[model samples]
Target: MENLPKKVRSKKLSTRVDLTAMVSVSFLLIIFFMVTIELAKPKAIDFNLPDNEWTYRGTHISCGPDVTRIVTILLDDNNKIITYSGLLFTPIVDPKVLNYGKNGIRQELFDRRKNITEYSTAIGKPKNGPIVIIKPSKKSNFKNLVDILDEMAIANIDTYAIVSDFTPEESKLLALK
Candidate 1:
């Protein structure tokens, strides 16, 4: 047998994998998702339904002197907004005709709210704003109600009610208009 010279081959190529670019791409995607994602904010109006007692005891719920702070808004036909302040039993401020817009009912509501807050502070009482009573007549459209509700929210009024009953004075006022 003849002796053969053995040739030494280079070590097998290393299979090292570079994961830096993959990691960077993963981080970028995560950042993009974090930046672009928006959380949903729910918009809603809170309403209180009349209880059984209220039904039995008549619709006019007495709110004391706060009644003076109560603002009654009547949604009339042809997008007319009539507003007054005070209780049904007592003499109320004369209903004023108003329009629908930023300068109209919205401004009045804002001013009334501000006045109530200032008056409360001046009288050394806790700031309790007026309670708005919204009465939508059968003649009023649905959009009028929605717009008034939106105005209530925009005015930052925390207390208000939607009463269906129309008192005699309200009826007379409507008739006169």
Candidate 2:
């Protein structure tokens, strides 16, 4: 008998998948989400405390400028704002009694800011504008203080200070209304 040649069959293999592209896309998506979300900024009220050492060159300590363009605001217990401008020694103009609203303190602040800017420019001292001194009386609540601060910011005031002292005259004014 003659030897017959047997046919050999080739074994089939499964398709191999390349996961490199999918992994790169997934990593890119994660990075994109991380960059898009914004973080919240902390809000705070700015306050300055007096230094413990109160002597300047063997004399009483004094701070800030002694100028005419100063606005003093006294916040009273009844949610009333009593405001006066110029030096304390200078004769006080009638204290303006204002409420907290768009047409109240905000309007007054805007008008005062405008007048101060104009006055400074006319006198050739453009940098010498108004400075607001906020004195919140013990009678006043926390909300009142916050409102005045918000008004200052809305009116675009650049210079302001929170002082705790209240002159006797200011105390009397608060007593009026």
- The candidate that achieves the highest lDDT relative to the unseen native structure: 1
Candidate 2: residue 27 Cα off by (Å): 21
lDDT tens digits, residues 1-177, model 1?
Answer: 367777788899879989999999999999888766743445576754222221112344543345556789999999998888766555346678899989999998998888777866765655567778899999999999999999988999888888899989898887787
TM-score of each: 0.62, 0.62
Q: Which stretches of candidate 1 lie over 4 Å from their true place?
A: 1-65, 88-92
lDDT of 2 by residue, 10-99 (tens): 887868888999999999999877766533345576643322322222364456442445688899888989887775556334468999
Among all windows of 10 consecutive residues in model 2, the one with the lowest summed lDDT is 48-57
Q: lDDT values of the candidates? A: 0.78, 0.76
Candidate 1 — worst ten consecutive residues by lDDT sum? 49-58
Model 2 — TM-score against the truth? 0.62
lDDT of 1 at 37: 70
